[model samples]
Target chain A: MGTQAIRFVGYIFGAALLGLLALPVTSLVGAISVQKFLAGVYHPLFWPAISLSLRTTILSIGFVVLLGTPLAWWMAHQTSRIGRLTTVVVHLPIIMPPAVVGVALLQAFGRKGWFGTLLSAQGLNVSFTVAAVVIAQMTVAAPFYVQASIQAFKKISPDVWVVARSLGASPIEVFLRVGVPMAIPGLISGVLLAWARALGEFGATLVFAGNRVGHTQTLPLAIFYALESDIELALVFSLILVLVGLVVILVISQW
Target chain B: MVDTSLIVQVQVSLGDFMLDVDLSISMKGRLAVIGPNGSGKTTLLKTIVGSVYPDKGHILVGDRVLSDTKLRIEVPVEDRQVGYVPQDYTLFPHMNVINNVAFGLSTGGRRGSRACKKEIALRMLGRFGCQQIAYRPVQQLSGGERQQVALAQALVTEPRLLLLDEPLVALDMTSRRVVRLLLQNYLSQLDIPTVFTTHDVRDVVSLADSVIVLSRGKVVQMGTLEELQKQPCNDFLVEFLGQQ
Candidate 1:
């Protein structure tokens, strides 16, 4: 009964949140107007964010995959208690809200943060630069990659992995040839989700990288920047972001 | 003739149940590990397959020393080539028939690796008379077909040793009889050693060349089917016979 009540409350909260969010969703969708959406696609800011977002998203995904795949595999292969603890730590950022991620990044990478001071001492101007965008994107987005990867590797029966190894595959080959394909569904889901998260990274980028046009203004940050002057333009950017998210989500689901 | 002599010594405890396995099997040999539910038969196999490590002892595959807890010489499973058909026949549900077969081979950056008439998966299927299920999802295959696919999958890798856990236990009697005969015929044609575990007496008498009777985790007896039948060692063997 308690579980049911909790679920009931969850549903109520979800519907209320959806109702509140629906305006932004509709504004985002409506800003398109189909015609403006197409023309908006040709906007200088629009294409730049799209291309930059695409490039950075791809790069971030690549980085996550390179680092995260091995970590996930190691984590999944573990049966010890420490392994379980590590998995919890790895998934912590994924469960955190985007705003918290931004705030955390701000404290850590902002001009006053620890790394910021070190970099400043070294005369490295990383703040409010393109690199800040990548860092902000990575902080908020990398966990999706790790989480997806761990789940993917976990889904593969250890039996298959053992068999693959016994059959003469090196650990690397087993991961590349067998592990990757076997866990493609989870792996791709992780990549697309992480990429999407990175593409639409806002709070972290805004707080850390600032809403500088053509530099760190990814689609989400661009939407916020536009909202200050033109709510319709903000909605237009948001509409495109939602469409891209939907398309990527659809693709990920199919995989 | 390939020398398929096998020897394994292992000791481990899982969830309050202790297991100690010590046995030897020879070329063209069929050893049936007979035991009741939760008697560590699967544990023994998993240890051999390299998924689980024993606390002590060694497994010698031909001249190669596969495991020794003292020296920490534990060979990884990808190098072991011990084909196992787990009880449930956990076939890849997402993959189609041929890809599942190809999973056994090296494809050199290809999607489907075992392309060598990976359809011999088909021949193995044809042996089970399931050639018509070439494209069907394993999830949709009947229990009998699933057993056939599992056997075919285990065979496709051309493993030197085959380990079967309750291969025929899941089948209906009719399917069991057919599958049993097919397996026997196939095994007779090859010299590779095979070990199967089951509580079914029919499984012991029908397929096993020798039997290792395990009760409460220890080997109580080891011999031919007729030998066990002729001299039922104790109440356990007698009761085992009666139940079977």
Candidate 2:
């Protein structure tokens, strides 16, 4: 074939692949009309799940930023053995199945589990609670932020940090004013990715936090339950998810 | 006299190379560290500035001991009150020229209100003739402009000692001459001891009062430019100085 013909064939193959992947989600989009979706989405059960998901995901993102920012910053500066090791350990969640994370968290924090026994003594139970849901979300999502943050901090020249320090900026001032500002773009991207991961978290929340209504049922769990009860309700939830996912992707790409 | 004497004795092992140097400069001294590539000029400068710690010896600026391995006293870089401009300029890309110049003064060395800091930064930039570009981001600045801002940033804090790594090395011939004149004018006004590294002997002739020749991580010779030129201590000094 001529070069132009080969190019044409390549375009065709690319388009076909894109179409194949988008078909299922596109069909789900077509399955729900805005009017119908709006009518069904106002159900008593729907608002609670929506609020719970928003609350937990937002809180989980806050936790990730609070914990992950310092961790990533410390890890970035550390040349010690523990620092090097954590670089490898931080990515474990991204590769592990979400269900595995759910199980692992359960083993560590379940009522009868290691830390859970100690906590339970003080009348605290984390398992099958909204807090468990947030924990599961964080476990699966924090790595994305941490990994991105580490790379961001690494991209900065050591000279910049040194210059800042030598300029008489205290360590805390250097980090807050210089390091954080310089790495803001990457940090922002990391936050977006982590939020998306937390939003879609399913298997871990199901296993660890359970699928209880009004108490622990987030949007993803709500959708699953909707799927078993009414097809239209499930379609509405899926459409909302797809829309949220779309908005997030658009924002990150544009940013 | 400003009592700006700097006494340095430092030994640091970097990779397979070892750097050992002992030197002293009087107040208002302008020392040019001249050497070929990998001659440890930058390493020595960084050592004195507290970026690279010396395995042995101490650095004293005036009466204050910046680093004393024997006394187990090592001042933190932030507390050293040294202004440093790396070879690449190392301007914070995210900040504008005003903010970059204002960094050191606002952060720790001197405390001023935000408006006062901005006013000081503008005056510094005005001295460099770069006040027009005060709001432009560092990334958007030209090489000469960046160097100007970097120098302004270093000097605004009114550091006790200044360390500049190849401040004029990155500019073209015209800009280099312009910046050299600007630096010479400004540096002459400051009574503090200043140490700058350079590959160009012209820079040494115009900007430096004394020259330190480094080779293989050791000080080969130290003297005035004319003295070094008049008396060739070694072939390296003769060749290095003869190049100008």
Native contacts, share recovered per candidate: 0.38, 0.92
Residues B1-244, model 2: lDDT tens digits: 5454899998999889899999998889999998878989999988988989899999999999999999998999998988899999999887888999998887764766899999999999998999999999888988889898998999888889999999898899999988898889888988799999998888888899999999899998889998888886777777777777
Candidate 1 C-alpha lDDT tens digits along B55-164: 88998777677789888999877667677888777676667765566566653243453555565566766765677888888778877788777777777767777888
Residue pairs whose backbone atoms clash in candidate 2: none
Instruction: Return the top candidate by DockQ.
Output: 2
True contacts kept of 1: 0.38
Scoring model 2 with DockQ, what do you get? 0.82
Task: Kindly list the per-residue Cα lDDT of model 1 for residues A1-255, writing each as its tens digit.
Answer: 799999999999999999997777775565468777666666677777777777777777788888888888898888899998987877777787767876777677667787777877888877687777787788777788888888888877766665555445678887887788778888889989998888878777777777778877778877777778877676678887888888997998788
Displacement of the residue A247 alpha carbon in candidate 1, Å: 3.3
Alpha-carbon shift of residue B32 in model 1 (angstroms): 0.9
Reference-based TM-score, model 2: 0.92
- What CA root-mean-square deviation does each model show from the true structure? 4.6, 2.6
